[model samples]
Target: MYDHYDALIFDMDGTLVDSGQLHEFGWSETLNKYGIPIDRPLMRSLAGVPTKATIEILLQKFNLTPTATLDEMNDFKEAWVHDNMHNFVKPTALIEVAKKYHGIKPMAIGTGAYTQEAITILGLCGLDKYIDAVVGADQVKNPKPAPDTFLRCAELLGAAPEKCVVFEDSKLGLQAAASAGMAGIDVLLVHAIENDYFL
Candidate 1:
């Protein structure tokens, strides 16, 4: 099913590796410690959103004034995830797909995760070698649901957006891919990794 594409673009956190749990936990733990109510479902839905966007949404949702600076909250959550990521993250079923396509079609990562975090997770999962480029949240002016990340990835791959396929686990990522004029494969990530739809 993927043969037609010249390049493949992947969303890192949930699509390439199983790190959503750590992210959710980090957010929940940090917010709770700051006396903020936990919204598990919201966090899940906002999986591919950038840290600042996620924080702003949560602040408005809970009607809580920020005690810490936005940078402080972002730093804390990222640190929490980093401290515990090694314990929970592992290669997903899509790693096999990445391996199969490695050195064949060009592959890149376009994620809402900061560049360092995305690179760290890709390295941890041993998927970094398979990818040719990574366009991260810090590098883009707009996050998922906008086409910037994916478009940039396609540019880096020297492929047309329509010739690239995006593997995404979030609705926002799918929207971003579509906005960039690329087809999308929705990698199921609820309880476990499932890429059967494309197989």
Candidate 2:
């Protein structure tokens, strides 16, 4: 429960912003540009995966050579996303939640997004200053479903991993939070538990 937590951590893409679909679209389009094909559903499922890891997995899954350069593909994806943020969903629930808890409890970002991109988007959405910390995928060796990113967020937030609560929309993010010994919020549940549960 969040009431039991000293800090609140959020997964950037799906949990806070509506960029998950854009990310899927971006990756899908980028892969296609490389002559590699990927299904939207599959890329959506891999939302919280690290960039390089996603490239590697997609290459194998698409039977393409592992020669898809991570940096280049990321450039393509970012360029597309940078051109389309206003049209994407804003995941206002996250912004509302952050406003509700900003001063009362420490809130931080633990995401599998590139540091610069994450900062740019969060800044655009006013989340950069709102959150206590932002831990990017590049800052860690292992990303979700590993505890590295979340744990780093907890550490930076000055909260014990077990004393923090994580809000995630993907299974991988949930696994990462659980591995960090924190409670996980499956944000996409249509009939999700109410604020009482978090409190």
Candidate 3:
């Protein structure tokens, strides 16, 4: 299915790894400690946004000024996620696609998570070896929906933006792929189809 693309780019959280719940737990725990309530819909809406960016959005959504700075909240949430991810992070079926093209085609991960955090999670899922490069939100000036992350991945892979295909689970990610002039595969719909087929 991906034969035509010169390279493949994947989003980490919901696309390559089943780490959404882990992220949600991290945010929930962090917010609770700060006396803020968790808003699942808002969290899910900002799936492909960077950690600090998401926290900023959440604070605005809740309309509560926090004692902690955005960086502090981001650090606390990321720390919790890193500490607990090993027990919860798992690879989704789409990992088979990455496994299939491991060396045949250049592959990169472009994620909203910090670069090192993405690496650690991929390692825990045994997917780090399959990827040639990783571009995190921290590495780019703008996160998903800006195309910077995927474009950087394409550049690092020596592939043109139009020659790359991105596998993503979030609307922002898909938009980013489009903005990068890359084809996008909606892994959520793909997973749903796969599940139905298996059933």
Residue 155 CA displacement from its true place in model 2, Å: 0.6
| Candidate 2 lDDT trough over 10 residues, lowest sum | 190-199
* Residue lDDT tens for model 1, 96-199: 88988999999999999999888988888888899999999999888788999999999999999999999998889999999999998888743356422111
RMSD of each: 3.7, 4.7, 3.4
**lDDT by residue for model 2 over 120-193, one digit each (tens)?**
88877777777888899989999899999999998988889989889987889999999999988888673242
Worst 10 residues of 1 by lDDT: 190-199
Weakest lDDT window of 10 consecutive positions for candidate 3: 190-199
In candidate 3, list every pair of residues with a backbone clash.
none
Runs off by more than 4 Å, candidate 3: 193-199
List the candidates ranked by TM-score, beginning with the highest.
Answer: 3, 1, 2
Model 1 vs truth, CA RMSD: 3.7
lDDT measured at residue 102 in model 1 versus the true structure, 0 to 100: 90
> Evaluated with TM-score, which candidate comes out highest?
3
Q: List residue ranges in candidate 2 displaced over 4 A.
A: 66-68, 190-199
